[model samples]
Every structure is written in structure tokens, then in C-alpha cells.
Target: MTSAPPTETARNDDQAPPPEQPAGRRAAPSPVWPGLRALAGLLRPQRGRLLAGIALGLLGSLLGLAQPMAAKHVMDSVGQGQPAVGSVVLLSTLVLAGGLLAGLGHYVLDCSAESVVCTARRRLTHRLPRLRVPVIEHTEPGDLIARVTSDTALLRRTAPQAASAAVTGTLITVATVVMMGLLDAVLLCVTLTVVAFVGLVVILVTPHIGRATRHTQEAVGRMGAGLERTLGALRTVKAAGAEQRETAALHRAAEYARRAGVRAAAWEAVSTTLSAVVLQACFLAVLGVGGARVTSGSIGVSTLVAFLLYLFALAPRVGQLVEGVGQLQIGAAAAVRLREAEALEVEEAESTEPDRPEGDGDETAPAPEQAPGSHERHRHPAAVAFQQVHFTYRPGLPPVHRHVSFTVPAGGMTAIVGPSGAGKTTVFALIERFYEPDAGRVLLDGRDVRRWPLARLRAAIGYVEQDPTVLAGTLRDNLTLGAADATDEQIAQVLRLARLDTMTGRLPHGLDTQVGHRGSRLSGGERQRVAIARALLRRPRLLLLDEATSQLDAANEAALRETITDTARRTTVLVVAHRLSTVTTADRILVMEAGRVRARGTHAELMARDSLYAELASTQLIAFR
Candidate 1:
């Protein structure tokens, strides 16, 4: 379903505001011209096919013109009492040939239009993923989907119909005018006078068509967004019994779109009616003026008949020209929205690895030495250190992290426990570089993380979000998302480590069983385990676990805690622990309140020194025990 266009506030939140128009610059150029130009550019790569289609359309139009002139010859021959059989045959052949050419031309133009839409969709698909995190967060996914699907599809209708009608209609109109002028200059002048007035009317109504079209398209987008919002949280909406309210909201959006569409149709209808009126007016003027001239012996009867035929042909062509302009306006409006989406800032593409040094042949060297008390081979865990980090979601907003400083040694487990909204998750976000700190340095393995290639930096770290996400797919698909090349044996190993092996055996299709949307078919513990297994598949040097056991039962949570502890022997582990039982055994713990670390020590040390930590241990932690 279509949705309303995003509001100015939504657009601004999704992207930086448009640059201010320069002083003295004519109010920002109409979106129509710029959008049309951009739409034309999309076809530039396929111009060969487009031009061929256009040429064929013109050929068809020329052939169509030939039919009227041929009919005039037959009429003239019959008036002279000639046999006229050959002329009749010639006219029949012209009609057949014109139909054939027109059909072929239409087919080719339709294919070209499809190709243009496909190219647009492919570009948008590639571009959307490259957009920054903040932009994606603010923009509705449904609106973006609409742009890729419905908005681009509009171009399929727009490109060929608009181009063919505009080009072929103009060609036919001009050719017919020339033919009429040859028959009689006085009649041609009379016909053109009516056409001139129609042209003025069309020019006056064209802007209204564009404005209405843009509004209608935006309303459709909004409707789609509304539907998406309701459906995405279908359970919540149903549980709250707000279905009627949501449906009413969507109806309002749909009504707005319907009204805008009606307005556009009204203007288009007026334009079309004016074209038809112009044709009838021109025909009357030509017939009356030509009849008078013939009586004066200024033109032959056959010439008058031929001129009228040309005028008859000219009407549909003029109507097509007007309709084509309307289609072009609609297409240009869609193009403007597409262009706006494309103009948003995107993150630079990252390579999989950093550049290697010349003659550096030690790629397979032994792993770096593990920190004290660590016990695991292949331990090359990355040491993370943050120095005075300061960050906020927006400039005017309160900071989420204020001069945060901490370190997690290589190949050891560090736990961060704090009250809600204490910036524990924000710390993970900074380490992942999802958001940059306003001021501070984050180091990985004693080197500034900013200096590492983005892909390399991210590949070296694995993060399991607090609320795990399980895509709608088979167990195997979800497990292999991070490690597509992982072997069956490796998959089994992680499943066992995460304690998901037992559940896998009970499934009807084992690993092949569909997990359903967001793993709705799986138990909460299974879903969490699947998420952990997926992360473990990457074999990351630094693992970030945010409430990894939050949804697990006691048995499952105990198993997961053991897995985390075991994993830390070979990889650096930083966990945001909600239940103190999960982190009491960690090498060190950081107590955070507000946005800063209030204390740092082992569980025993912190419980002895910090009042908040002592209280939390006695309350939340002791209950779990």
C-alpha cells in the first residue's frame, strides 16, 4: 500500500537539510526541469535502444500520414470516373503497413521503459545500504521500499509513453501542418489560430498537474509507511486494541492521495478536452474557409478534401502531445523524489583488508602472546582502550558518554554493569564505530581504531545486540549469515558450544527448519543461542555481548555463561551484564552510573568499595543466586 510522503521534519531528520539557495539566485529551479534532466540521464546509457524505438515510432507516424494522402488520390480518381482499383489497393496496403509499424514501435518502447526502471531499482538497492546509520534510523523502511518499488515503476509508464507521444505527436503534427499548407495556405492559417489558443491553455495548466502529481505520490508513500508501522508491530497493536485507530489513520492518508489524484485528473481532463475542442474548432474553420475559397476557384475540391483529412489526423496527435506533457510532469516529480534520496550522504565503501607491506611474508606468524591467566591457543585478542570519549546523539542533546575511559586487556573478560540508560550499550556502539565520539581516542590492539580499514576493524569484532535479531530463514541460513563459507562441522561445533544442538535435533528438519520471521518459531532461549552461534562463526578477536543471556532460562543462561567464559580464553570479551550472576566471575568489572564509570575492580573489590555496587549485588544479584 502507498503511504504519504515524509514531512519536512522527517526529511530533515533523515538527512542534512538542503543547502541554502545562493543570494540573488532565482528561487530554486523548478524540480520539473532538473528532475526531467536527471530522468533523461538515466536513459543515456541505453540511448541506443531509446533512439531506435523513437525512430520506429516516427516511421510509423510517417506511414500513417501517407494513408490520408493516398485516400485523397483514390477520391480524386473516382471523381474523374477512372477505374481507381489500383489506388484502392495502394490505400489498403498503407493501412496494413502503418498498423504493423506502430505495433512494433510500441513493443520496443515498452521494453526500453522496463529497462530504465530496472536500472533505477538496481541503483537504489545498492545505494540504500550505503546510507549512514543515523539516516537509516530516522527514515522509514517502508517509505524507502516504496521508492524502490512503486516510484521506480512509475518511470516504466512515464518514459516510453511520454517520450513517444511527445516526439511522434509533434512530428505528426508538424508534418500534417506542412501538408495542409501545401493544399491551401488560407486553411492552414485558420487551423493554426485555434491550435495556438490550445497551446496557451496547456501551458497554464501544466504546473498544476506537476504539483498535484507530487502530492499524490507523497501521500501514497505515507500510506505505505503507516501500514508498515502497524504491521511491523502487529502484536503490540492487537494487544493494545488500537486496530481501528490505525486503520483510520491509514484511511486518512489514502483519502489525501485520492483527493490529490482527483485534482491531477481534473487538470489533465481539462487539457485533453481543450485539445479535442481545438481540433473541432480547427476543422470547422478549415472546412468553412476552404469551401469559400473553392467557390472562388482558389482551390480544387480534391485539395479541400485532402486538407480536411489532414486536419482530422492532426487532432489525435495534438491530444497526444498534451497528454504526453502531463505524463512527463508526473515522471519528473517521481524523479525529483528519487534524486533527493540519492543526494543523501553515504558512508564510504570499505575494503575487506588494509594494504599489506611489500615483501611482508609473515602473514602466518604465531598469534600474539595472551594476557596473564588466559588459556587458549590461537589467542590474538585485540586490546581495547578508550580515552576521554565524549558523545551525544545530537548536538543539542545531553551527552550519552562523558569523558568515558576504560580498558579491556587482550584475551580476558571485562564486564560493564550499570543501571538502565547508563551508557553501557553506547560504549559498544562507539567501539563498533556505528557512531563516532565527539572527542576521544578508541584503540584496538594499542593502535587507534580509526586508522584501521573499516571492514577490517568490524571483521575483527563481533557484537550480539541486546535484542537479538533472527531473520526469516532456515537455521542454517541464520547461522551462516556472518560466515557464509563455514563448513557443516564448524556449524555443528558452534551449535554445541551455544547449547543449541539439543533443540536442533528435535526440529522436524533439523538445521533446514524455517525459523520464521524474527525466529518466532524458536523459543526465546533458542533465538538467543542462534544469535550467539552466528556471532561465534565469525571467530572475531574481540567479542561484544550486550545482555546475551537476558532472554535465556536458568539452565540456558548457565550454559551461555560458560560458553562466554570459554570463548574469552581465546578472544577478548566485553559484556554488558544485566544480572550480576553472569559477570561476578569476570576478570574485572566496571560500575557505571549516568555516563561515567563510578568504580572499577573485581566483583568482590567493587562490592566492598562502592555503595551502589554493594546494593545491586545484595538485591538483584543475590536474588538470581
Candidate 2:
């Protein structure tokens, strides 16, 4: 009879992987325009808001132009004789209104930017979960985090600011030049000529400024990666006494970030300050020639005053271009990094052409109802088989598992024992379909396993990892990890069978007692039993236990062995054994050496025949005793 399915959500690695180490020589940075063009797509949906922002910014820039003109009018009026109160009031009001408009304009632009960012974050967060396991396995967590969080934040801030500034700057500059021409056409010509030169300089410097900014963001991400590496290995570092070495490594990464940041800042400062300086120089020239024109009766003092006011109004807009250039560069750099992770290969769910019922002979047999452990419709009780399975992490790298072929039949417990790097864990990994074999097929009951949806296939087998991950929850909750939906009676029964029922009885809250992080609150043996109870709760047809008893003491180990011996009678058990006890107790042992099974037989038969088995039995079996 089938058992209750696990009610718990599939435990997942929600965190992103580290950034992929760049291959070979460092790639030369691409032109920023492409990144900017890519960013433009993000803005398309908010074009109406963007346009409104630009319009407001232009009005604000025009109002700002009136501020200096109003001050000049007040000065001229006072000098002439008596200043008109009405005129002064009107000019002051214009200046005040302009300031308000500028503030509102900024708000609108920022709002649009926020909208774009929200959309991008939503899209990326959703996509991350859907990504293939292999893609996530190959990626770096820190770099992906930087892209999703930090880089996107930068884009939101920069895009709107740049767009608004570009619009306002263009309008103000043009308005100022026109006002100057009204004062004295020849003088305006000289002023605008210098302004043109400044514009040219800004354009020439913009691309480089963006490149430098992008490099700065990347350097920062690398610093984060370094921090992650250090933290992940904190225990190892402490054991090895390598704190100083890690500190130095982090410092180097920080230095690179600092250098990149400084370079970006320097370029921004130079470009902006130059624009201001050139504008000032142009103002001086306009003044010198306008003074000559006024004396010659070719221009009025009021006209020259208004022209200078317009020029000063143009400064904020011009300054924005410089800052915009810097931010745009930063955004581009972030995009490149983000794009790297975005390009990961997401695996699709395999097609399941349900098995035909014997009498009906129809092609569409219902897919198996998913339970804690349930096989697909086509699944039969043959065995696990790898037919010429070839696998690799990346192209051109040596294959991790090459042309590996093996079989473990149903109804008997098979122990696969091998040395480190013999691709032992990889066998479990392939069976679970964490990755597809590059070439070849994995068969279960003579049917290619790849034909089954990964979820259904994994549900068919109970897996207990070496580390035996246990969440922080009640003891009962942990025991029912895979069988969340299991009834209390079923839970109580499993607890009794795994020999954890006595522990549960002693607990202050019975089964409800909280288990701390990774079940640290429990003893090693208790944790192992909890995992076993969890697997057993599913009444799995096929049980996969990976070094389940490695953490237990002798007494607990014996108890666990007894439990496993009982459970195996009702299920097909395959174990990756680290202990000789497990190997000896296993009905049959498959001794693996260098990614291939070298020998397979009962413990006594193998020990009596195979030299390697005999040697292992002598050394490790004695150690087990």
C-alpha cells in the first residue's frame, strides 16, 4: 500500500551561485552604447512618465533662467532710480516657481526609475527559481546577488537621472545661446563656439567614464565574492590558522575596487568641472564683447543681463550630463555582469508519455500520483541501470563520469563503495537527474529515466545525504521531513520503528520539541534516526541512504543497523556505505573503483574471492569492530 506524500515544500537552494570565474584571458570591455541601448528597453513601458519628467525638467530649467534675469532687473531698476515693487515681486515669484518645478521634476523622474526597477526585480526573482539545477550549480551566489540586488539598484538610480538631465541640459543650453544672440549676434557666436567645444569634450569623455564606472561595480562584486569565500570556510580557516591570509586576500580585492572607483570619480570630476570652467570662460567673452556693443549702441544693458542669466541657468543641466555620463557608465558595467548570470541554461521538464494499461492498450495512462516516494507510470521493478553514461561540467574539460555503465537489481540491498573522486556521489546525482548525462542513458526498469519528469523520478526514491540536513523545527517535524502530510499515527509508528520513540517520550514537548539549527540541539545519532524516520515515513519503494550512520556512535549505529535491516525487507535499499558494518550487512556489495564497479557479490563470497574485497574486509571490517 502507498503512504502519505511529504507535505513539506521541496527543500531547495534558494541562494544564487558565485560568479563564474572568467575563462582564459580577461575579455576586453565592450562599448557602453550597447549596454545603454539594452537599458533603453527597460524604459519603454514607462515612456509616458519619462516624457512628462523631461517636460517638467525643461520648464524648471527655463524658470531657473528667469532667476538670474530677475536679479539683474532688480539691480538695474535700483541703479536707474526707484525699483518697481510689482516688477520685483513678479521676478521673485518666477524664480520661486522655478525652484518648485525643479523639485517636482526630480520626483517624477525618480518615480519612473523605480517602476522600471520593480519590474526587473520581479522578472529576475521569478526566473531564478525556474533556472535549471546545473545552471545554478555552475554559478556563483555572490555575483548573482550583486546583479539582482546591487546592480539593479544602480540602474534604477542612474537611468531616470540621466534621461532627465539630458533633456534639461539640451533645452537650457539652447535657450541660453538664443538669449545671447539677442544681446549681440557676433558676441553670441563666440560664446556658442566655446560652448560647442565643451560639448565635444563631454561627448568624447562619456564612453570612457562609463567603462570605468562598470569596472568599479565589478570590482565591488569581486570583493563580495571574496567575503563569501572567507565566511563559507570560516571553520577551515580557523583550524588552519589562515586568518591573516584571508584578510590580505580581501584587502587585495578591496584595493581593486577602490582603484576602479577612484578612476571613475576622477573622470566624472574632470568632465563636469571642465564644462563649468568652459561656461565661465564663455560668459567672460560674452561680457567683454557685449560691453563693447553696448557702448557702440548695438546692444542694451538689459539684454546682456538677461543673456547672462540664461547662461547661469544652463549650468545645472550641463552639470547633469557629466554626472549622467558617470552613472550611465556604471549602469552599463553592472548590466554586463548581470547578463552573464542571465545567460545560464535553464533545463526544461521532460515529456512523460504515460504508460498504457494492459487491457486498454491506450497511450495515455495516467501519470503516477506524486507521493513521498512514488515512481512514474512506466517505472517497473527491474533495477537502476546506466548505459554508456557520459557527463561533463563544461565543454573541453575532462569528463567527470565517462562512459560509465552499471546496474543494481531490485529486491536486494546494493552497497556502492568507492574512494574519493571515483564519482560516487555523482552516481546519486545522476540518478536524481540534477544534471543530464551529456551522452548516454540512465534506465530504471528498462525504461530510459530521462523520459520521466524529474520531480516524479526523484519522488520514487528516498535520499538521505551524507551531512543529513535537518531544519530547525519540532522533533516531529524533522522526523516527517519528506512525509509532511503523514498522519500523526503514521508519524508515531515511524518514530517507533526508527527507535526514536523513546527519545520523543523523554522530550518535554514529546514530538513537538524544537530542534535547533541543523539539529545541533540533538546528538549525532538522534539526528541520523530523525533522517531515517523521515525516509521511512514515506514508505518509499526505493530507499537511498548515503552514509546515514557515519555520525552515530557504536550503540546508536547498532540500533540504526537494526532499523535499516527491518526497513529493507519492505523496500529496495541502495546505500553508499562509508562503514564496513553497512557493507557486510548489505545483501550484496558493489565495490566501485575509478567510476566503474569492479566486483559484486555477498560479503562472504566477495571476501573469499576478490583480493580487494578481502583486503577491505580485513582492514575496514576490523576497524568497524
Candidate 3:
């Protein structure tokens, strides 16, 4: 039977389901071939360098073929009692030249591979910020890092080495077989038969190697994700005395990775052992057959000896070829992961027009700026209107905003008060176009927000989130993030407005003090003030404050409230108020409940007309007393 829809009470913030884990390995069907293609595409741009490397490799292999012939000539001369010093010296020269050429070829191949990896990393980095917000929300941070770091590194180490070995080894094997035919066609047939059987076995085993490697890489990613989760919440885990449980969880993930690696190693061992066995078996077969031919005088002793030497040379090439195939499988698996990351949906590119400073003549221009402390203004502030806007986080989920409609007039403080799940934050998300409404329009200054260039539209707005983020840097660095060109005077003006000037003066280094990781060095109230100061420096036309005073004590909260009120006189202010005191004096108030605006008016009007609003006001008022 179908379950009933969730009731309003069931939709509380704490009860919402966590995001689903990605399907990962199971989601991929036929990952190997696609990964191989991706690898090829990545290297395609560097094909010229790759081809040069291949040519050099082939030259080195061909030169190597002459060594055995030279040795044979030297042996024949020594046996005949002729002068052999010249032959010996010639043989040494061939060995030295071939080694040098092969070394140069290997060097070129490695350089090309590194270049491909660098390009892949750059693309992944560039694509990250462009990905849609929902994609980022669902992805694990550590797993994403694994793709860019470990997985790409695997591709770099494996692709060119494998390609060069496979190509050079195959060519050398064919050339050796041809030379063997010239010596004796029957012996050539025997060698060909043995090689053909070994090649078939390697081909049959190759796909399993790819499958095992793909699983191994995925397990490593899972392990990384688990560790990141533990580290991110380490303090909470320790405080709750759940360290043992988190440790066990991480141990299990590590064990999973270990098992996967073992499985891959097992497959690789099998491939290597089979290649070794092929070489040994072929050597015995050639020795026995060639012994009979030498005894029967069908082939000369020296000729048979030279042919056996050539067969000996063929063994290593064949082994290298098989090893290269195995490495290719590993590379292909890594390529699959990289391709998956690159395939995420990215945000639409911003308009081609260059971003102009605020108050440009374009329709998206910011409101006129007033002096820092000036309250006088003649022009109207930017107006924000929501007309029947609708949104839901995912399909089949209940809407977060159901035909929501409201308007905030220019140049005043407008406060939003709501229960935890009443969708107060969704309003700001729509206005910022982080999300698009399903049915209706969100207008900025009477123009649909979607029509404005994304960059320019954001430039005219400043937002302070409830959980303020202060990066690991000096105070000045964090404050200047949104306004890189802010002068010291402008910086001081914002600090004064945020009531942070006093705090800065007390610090040992003032603005140069390090914030530590995520601003752990600062007190909660100070961090919130710093966030406010950062936003103010932008001089935005529309300022969004989401629970901006939640971390402040009574004194700081009151000061911030006054500062907000002052800011509203010259620019539009929309705040999601957690405490009723912050909005009691707001010029207009919006009371929201169950994803709808239940009432909108002055605080007194809301208390007199709306029962829910009256209940909320009384609850907070009682707590305050």
C-alpha cells in the first residue's frame, strides 16, 4: 500500500531526510570502454608528441634487433680463428647506442603523459565552481578530491607507459618472427603458434583486470570520503564520546579498500605469471626442435644459435606487451572516474558583457550610493517582488514555497519570521537566483531576475548567512574577499558599521591577525560581526541578512539591530529573523507559516490579527521577561 503524505508537523527541519548517497560503482554500466575512450580523448591533443615518442621507441627496438646478429658474427669469427677484436667492439657500440635511444624514448613518453594529466586536472578544477549547486550538495568533498588527485595521477603514470610498451613490444615481436622465418620457415611456424596461444589467453584475462581495478579505485574513494566526514565533525564526535564508533566506521572503510586492492593485485599476478610461463615453454620448445635440426645438418650450428638468441630477445618484449595491457586496464578505470566528474551539469555561462561597477547605466545597475553615515536619499531603492513563486528541492517532494507572493518596498527594513520549516531561507535563494522558481517570477527593480547577467545581478546584492564562513587567513584577507579593491578607508568604514572597530583595536595585530582554520580563533559574536563587515564593504543595493544576529549576545544583538536599521535607510534590507526582538521594530514584517505568508504588516498589526503570530510573539516575550 502507498504511504500517506507527510503531515505539516512531520516536515520539521530536524526530521528532513539526509541526501541520498550516490550510486557510485553500481551506477556505471560498461565503465571500461568509456573510460578508455575518455583517456584517448584526453591524450588526443598531444598526439604529435605521442607519435614522436612512438617513432623513437620503434627505432630503439629495431636497433636492438642488430645486437644478436652482431654477437653471432663475433662468435663465428672467434671459432674460425680470425681476428675478433673489431667484431667485439662493434657489438659493444650497438648495445650502447640502442640503450641511449630507448632511454630517450622513455623520457619523451613520460613527459607527454604528465602533460595530459596536467590538462585533466585543470579542467576538473575549472569545472568545479561551474557545477550546479545541487550537484555539489550531493557529492562528497573527499571523493571529489580523489578524482582530481589520485585518479588523475593514476592515469598519468599508466597511459603513456602502457601505450609505448604495447606498441614497441608488438612491433619487435613481429620483426623477430620475420627474421626467424628467414632463418627457417618451420621454426618460425612453431614460435608463431606458441605466441598466438599466449596472446589469446592475455586477451581473455584483460577485461577482468579492468573490472578489478575500477572496483579498487572506487573503494579508495569511499575510504577518503569516510575520513573527510570524520575529520569534519571531529569535535562533535569527541564531545559526544563517540570516538570509538567513528574509528570503527573508518576502519571498515579502510578494510574495504584493502580487500579491493588485494583483488586487483591477484589479477595482475595471474597475468604476469602466465607471461612468464609462456616464455619458459617457448624456450624449451625451440631448444628441443633446434637441437634436432642442428644434429640433422638442416641448419648450421651458428644459425641455430643466432635464432635461439633472437627467440630469447622476443621473450622480454612479449612480457612487456602483456604488462602494458594490464596497465592500460588500470588507466581506463581511472579515466571512468574522471569522466563522471566532468559530466556533472554546470551553471550556464554568464553573459558576454563585461561586469560594470555598481550603478552602471544598464538595467541591472545598483542603487545610488550614499555617504557611509548619510541617511538622506532621494532616489528609490531597488524593489524586490515575488509573484506566486513555487519551488521544491527535488521532484516528488513537497514544495518549499507554494504560490508564495510578497513585496518588499524600496529603502526599508523588511523582516521575515517563520517556523523552522516555513521556507524563510528559500525566499533569499530565489531572489539570488541560486534556484529558479517553478511557476512564477522573482522581480528585481520590476525586471525578472533571470534577464540580468548572473555576475552583475549578484554584484548588486550582499548576503550574510546564518552560519558565517570566515576563511583561513588574516582578518584583512577575509574581509577583502568580496571586495578585493576596497581601500583602507572603505574597510574602516564597514568595520565601524559592524561594531567591530573596538574588537580590532584590542587584538595584538589588529586587522593582520590570523583567523585560524574557519575562523576558530575568533569568538562566535566576533565572527558574525566580521561577516557583516565583509558584506558592508561591497556597498550592495540589496542586503540579505539570514539570522545575522543569532550568535550575538544581548548587547551586541542590540547594537547590530541598530546598525541594520541605519543601513536600511539607504538600501533595501531583507532579514530572516530568528529572534522576535530583532524584527519588533522593523518597518514591515512578514509572518510565514507552512510555506506561505500568513500575515504581513507592522508587529502590532500582526499580533492583533494573526493567532499564530500572536502565539510566537507571546512565547518570545515570555522568555525575554
Question: What TM-score, over all chains together, does every model reach?
Answer: 0.89, 0.81, 0.91
Between prediction 1 and prediction 3, which has the larger TM-score? 3
In model 1, the runs with Cα more than 4 Å from the true position are 1-30, 351-379, 621-625
Ranking by TM-score: 3, 1, 2
The residue-by-residue lDDT of candidate 2 on 254-326, one tens digit each, is 9998999899888888887788888788778877987888899887777777766666655565667666666
Report the number of backbone clashes for model 2: 9
Score each candidate by Cα lDDT. Answer: 0.78, 0.70, 0.80
Q: Model 2, stretches more than 4 Å misplaced?
A: 1-27, 65-93, 127-139, 350-383, 392-402, 409-412, 469-541, 569-571, 621-625
Question: Worst ten-residue run, lDDT, model 2?
Answer: 1-10
Give per-residue CA lDDT, model 3, range 225-303, as digits (tens): 8888887767778999999999999899889989989988998998888888877888888889999998998998888
**Error at 87, model 1, angstroms:** 2.8
- Candidate 2: the clashing residue pairs are 7-484, 7-485, 16-141, 17-140, 17-141, 18-140, 18-141, 19-140, 210-329
- What value of lDDT does candidate 1 attain over all alpha carbons? 0.78
